[model samples]
Target chain A: MKLAIMGVGAVGRSVVDLAPDYGHVVTAVADSSSAAVDPSGIDVDAVFDRKERGGVVGSGDPEDALDAEYDVLVEATPTTLGDAEPGFSHVRAALERDRHAVLANKGPVAERYGDLMALERESEGTVQFEAAVGGAIPILSTIADFGPSQISAARGVLNGTANFVLSRMAAEGLGYEHVLAEAQDLGVAEADPAFDVDGTDAALKFVILSNVLSQGERVYSLEDATVEGIRDIPASALDLAAEDGRTVRLIGEATADGVRVGPRLVPQHDALAVSGTRNIVQFETVNAGQLHLSGRGAGGPETATAILSDVGRLE
Target chain B: MKLAIMGVGAVGRSVVDLAPDYGHVVTAVADSSSAAVDPSGIDVDAVFDRKERGGVVGSGDPEDALDAEYDVLVEATPTTLGDAEPGFSHVRAALERDRHAVLANKGPVAERYGDLMALERESEGTVQFEAAVGGAIPILSTIADFGPSQISAARGVLNGTANFVLSRMAAEGLGYEHVLAEAQDLGVAEADPAFDVDGTDAALKFVILSNVLSQGERVYSLEDATVEGIRDIPASALDLAAEDGRTVRLIGEATADGVRVGPRLVPQHDALAVSGTRNIVQFETVNAGQLHLSGRGAGGPETATAILSDVGRLE
Candidate 1:
């Protein structure tokens, strides 16, 4: 498959690096500032080298790559809330042209899922965004395979940075600020970690999953969720929970009525109570019972792996 | 879609009960001794009442159901070794007639995956057998979504019966015999139970997963796996393992070179160390890292949910 990748960040770079190994060709590339276009195939290695050595990805306009010849458009840009901007427009343009869109970005799906489905109705192509939720955990595909109505609810430890802080606070009896500092030092949390630490990241993922569980019957956004962060969780609370054989985790839950993200107490031995930066999503189904999935929720190659899998679905 | 079910067992009955809810109509049904066929749709409730009231499912020739008008064949017969006959021939006949086959019987898949794939190549339809392993966990589709070559290995607690016995023995500090008896009284284990307790069940599941992961490049059977049962695990062993904060689980694993089923020590907090009759499967992937899935592995409704999902996939 011919591919055009937007957002030459960590996830995009990994996708460019791994696509060939999966028998896919990169036809166009675009970073936030510059763009490269080739109808045959882009020289991905040269683009990476240029980006590494203080040079732009290319000298072309980003719009050039968007209009380039390709079967699928991979959107991996930084997420935005309101209108979902360039990512949403890029996906819309691809779908309008009957070209498949595989999104690693959450902005479009969480905010404009209904509009995207509306576009799909008149377009010849489909959109898949498995990486929008649980990285490479296959959460969306699992829900799809099980059929939406079979799933009653989806709850999970979605944001790795919040999970890391919570896990450290529980294990070492450290305060939230202490763990946040350690996590930032370890590169698990970004310098401006408010998105993850304040529950926006996890809530966005639930919004995406809520829309999927509704089978596009509804659209959910960060504003619709009941959000709570782990910033105020005290080490004393962890110690109290440990006394009862429980651990506190930042859980995101999406049901038919609503979606919420908060710090909840899970049994210490429960599968959802995974440690460190790991994430776990469990779907409550009527006949199939509870299906639990856990893995690294955020990473370059891991998220790219999901993007690659979505690309494969276009086949 | 029109459907034909080959067995009147628990799983088959649940499929009959749930198919209509999913907008699928059963056109034919066959038990070991009787059969019914209708081009429009069968009266599934009537068929159930007949079976519950001490009569067979229907009174036609079994072959009548096979040749009836249907888009997919649901094979849920009892599993047998050696030739994997009857089930294998039924699947072949469905493919020969350009009908998709969704199998709940493990015999045909564990022993005849290559043959069935060959039939798929020559026919107009495909085969799906998620019910043959991990019941409702969506293990096969998960691997398929990731692309098989991206996975390095698959390891799991695939058998609920064995897991039930082991978990009971560990939690209650009881012997294997005591827990097996308890499991049987609770209807968790079959009266005979050898296939499950002796590791053949787990081994068969791995063999099927191995063929899937290898994309039918290799065929594995019960004879190919290194098997070990939990029959002789002493309570003292469980007690000793608990000292080190570990729990014993029946682990089934399939890699490129080999497949095996045995009792292995897992960390007490590890996701794979699930309790009771729950099952978990972990895939070691190149890019996604270790993806863990856990759920009910075996049960009438659980396995039937898998069959229903496969039916949905035929669309």
Candidate 2:
């Protein structure tokens, strides 16, 4: 498969590295500033080498990659709220041009699921976004297999940064600020971690999952979700919860009632009580009972694996 | 879609009840003693009314249903070892006729994966057996999304009966025999539970999952796996393991080295440490890291949902 990648960040770079093993080639590569386009295939290794030496991926504008000759457009840019521009526009452009869109960016799907799916119906190509939510856990695909009506509810620990902080606070009896500092130092939390620490990251993921579980019958934006972060969780609360064999986790859940994200008490032995940076999604199906999926929720290579798998699905 | 059900057992009965909701019709149905054939569609409600009175599903020979016209064949018979016959023959017959085979029986898959897949290659129809392992957990389909080569290993707690027995023993500090007896009384285990207690069930599931993870590049049968039962586990052992913040689980694992099934120590909070009749399958993908899937491993409705989902895939 021929590919055009927008946003030469961690996920995009990893996709370029791993695409060949999955029988895929990047025809164009783009960063925020520039892009390299080729009708045949771009030299991925050379591009990586150039970027490693602190150079731009290409000399052309970023939009050049979007217009390149390709069968699929990989949208891996950092997510933004509101209109979810750039990534949303890139995905729309690809679909309009009759090229499949495999997204690592969550913005478009979480915000404009109905519009994107509607566009897919009219376009010759389809859209896939496994990397938009649980990285490599195949959450969306599992829900797709069961269909929306069969799924009663969906819940999970989606944001790794928040989970890491909560797990650390419980395990080490550390304060939230201390753990946040440690997490940032460890590169688990970003410098500006409000998106994760304040629960927006998990809320965004839940919104996307909710859209899937509802089959677009419902649309759950971040504003529609009731969000809460782990910033105020005290050590005393953890101690009290542990007495009952329970622990606090920042859980994101979506049911017929609505989508919610907040610190919830989970049994210490529950699958959703995953520690560190791991993530889990549980779907309550009427017939299938409860299905739990867990894995690394975020990472460059891991997210790239999901993107590649989506491309493979096109086959 | 038109369907021929080859077993009028629990799963088949539930499929009859639920198929209409998924836009499927039972064209034919059969039991070991009798069969029903119709080119149009069978009267599912009437078949259920007859079966409720302890009569065969149909009056014709069982072979009659196998040779009938249908777009897909649903083989939901009880599994048997060695040749895995009857179920194997049913699947083979359907594949030969270019009809899709959706199996709830594990025998044909665990014992003769290669032969069945080879037949599928030659036939126009495909074979799907999500119910063969993990009931409705969608383990095989999840692995298929990542492809075989991307998976490094797969480990899980896959047998409901054994897990139920073990969990009861640990919770109540009861002996295995006592727990097994209680489970039997509760209809959780069969009267003759060798397959469930002696680890053959979990081993069979792992074998099937291994074949799926390897994508036909590797074949694992019940004979090739190392199996052990949970009958000898003492209550004291459970107590001892719990002291180390761990619990013993009947874990089935397949890696590059080999496939094995036995009682192994797992962290009490580990996702695979699910209690009772629940099951979990974790795939260690090279790029995705570790992916965990958990759900009820058995039950008529749960297993039937898997069969229905597989049939949906035929579309």
Candidate 3:
């Protein structure tokens, strides 16, 4: 597959770097301000070197890369809320051109699934966003393989930042402020971690899962989710839970009725109580009972692998 | 698709009962002694009723069902070790006729994967044995989706009966013999539970997994696996592990090197430490990092659901 990547972030760079290993070629790449276009394949190392020394990836408009010849458009832009703009428009441009869109961005899928599907229905292209949820874990494709209706409910610890904070607090008896500061120093949490610490990030992922689980019977957006983060969870709470052989995890659940993301009490030894940044999702299957999938929920290379897997699935 | 099931055991019965729900028709069913054959669709409830009263599924010879016309052959027969007979022969007959084979029997897959693939190569049919591994866990399909070469290693607690025994012994501080007795009494273990408690069941599953993970570069049989059962684990061992916040599980690990099944220690809070009759498999991917999948490893309906999922995958 020939790929055009829209974004020069960690995920986009990783996708460009690893495409050849997966028997794919990156034809074009675009950062916010610049674009690099090659009809055959882009010089990945040169693009990254140029980006490192200068702010621009190439000496061309970002729109040039969007218009470049490619089989699939990999949308790895930063996630946004509400209208899911620029990202949404980029996907639309790809679909309108009868090209497939593989997304690592949560914006278009979580905020505008109905519109995305509508656009897909009219085009020769398809949309796949496995990276929009559980990074490298094959959750979305698993749901696709096993009919969506067969899954009764899905619940999991989705936000690595929130989970890290809670687990650290539980493990070392540290306060939230201390752990957040430590996580920031360790580069585990972003400088401004509100999106993750406030439950919105996890909420968006669950919202996307809810949309898929509903099978278009009903579309879910961020507003439909009942989300509560770990911001208010105290170290004392973890201590109290531990006394009863339990721990706290920021869990997101998507069912037929709705989606919920909150700090829930799970058994101390439960699969959901994974330590550090590890994420786990449990599906209540109708016939198979409960199925749990866990892996690195977020990372540049991890999310890029998901995008590549999605690209591989495109027909 | 029209399915011909070659067993009247629990799993085959569930497949017959649930075929309609998955938009499939069971045209033929066979027990060790009798066969029920229909070109269109058989009466599932009537077959079960006959089996319960008369100890036979129908009046015809078992060979008749194998000869019946069907799109897919579901081999749910009792698993035999050496030569993997009659199950292997049943699958061969189906493939010779260019019919897809979805197997719940582990024998043909664990012992004769190469032969099975050889048969599939010559015929128009393909072989799928998801139910032969982790029942409802979707482990095989997940590995297939990720590409076998992309996965580095796989390790987990795969046997439900052995897991039940180990987990019960750990939680209750009971001896292995006591737990095994309780498990047998509760119907979790068979009367002659040598296959499961002796690690052969888990070894066979791991052998099949190793075969798949190797992508036919190498084939593994039960004899190739280094097997160790939970029979030797004592109450003192469980107590010692608990002191260190760990538990013993019949863990099976398969990689490019080889397959090993034995009682191993895992963190109490680890995903591999799933309790009761539950099963879990963890895959170490080259790029995606560690991925854990857990679910009901075995049951009539659970295994049936996996068989149905495989059937759905067939073209």
Q: Who wins the DockQ comparison? A: 1
Which candidate, 1 or 2, has the higher lDDT? 1
Candidate 1 vs 3: which has more TM-score: 1
Expressed as tens digits, the lDDT of each residue in B110-173 for candidate 1 is: 9877788889999999899999999889999998899999999999899999999988888899
Residue-by-residue lDDT tens digits, candidate 2, A1-315 = 999999888899899889989998789999888888988889877777777786788778889998899999999999988889889899999999999999989898888777889899999999999999988788888888888889999998999999999999889888889999999999999999999999999999999888878776777687788999988889889989999999999999989988899999998877788989999998999877888888888999999999998999997
Decoy 3 TM-score against native: 0.98
User: Measured by C-alpha RMSD in angstroms, how accurate is candidate 2?
Assistant: 1.5
* lDDT, each prediction: 0.90, 0.89, 0.91
- Give the alpha carbon lDDT tens digit for every residue of A1-315 in model 3: 999999988899889878888899899999889999999898888888899999889988999988999999999999999999889999999999999999999999999999999999999999999999989999998898778988999999888999999999999999999999999999999999999999999999999999999999999999899988888888999999999999999999998679999998998877788899998899999888989999998998899888888888884
DockQ of each: 0.92, 0.86, 0.80
List the TM-score for candidate 1's chain B: 0.98
lDDT for each residue of candidate 2 in B252-305, tens digit (9 for 90 to 100) = 998887779999999877778899999988888887788888888899999999
Report backbone clashes per prediction: 0, 0, 0
Residue runs of model 1 more than 4 Å from their true location after superposition = none
Question: What's the TM-score of every candidate structure?
Answer: 0.98, 0.97, 0.98
Docking class of 1: high
B253: Cα error in model 1, Å: 0.6
| lDDT of model 2 at position A304 | 95
Give me the displacement of residue A3 in model 1, in angstroms. Answer: 0.6
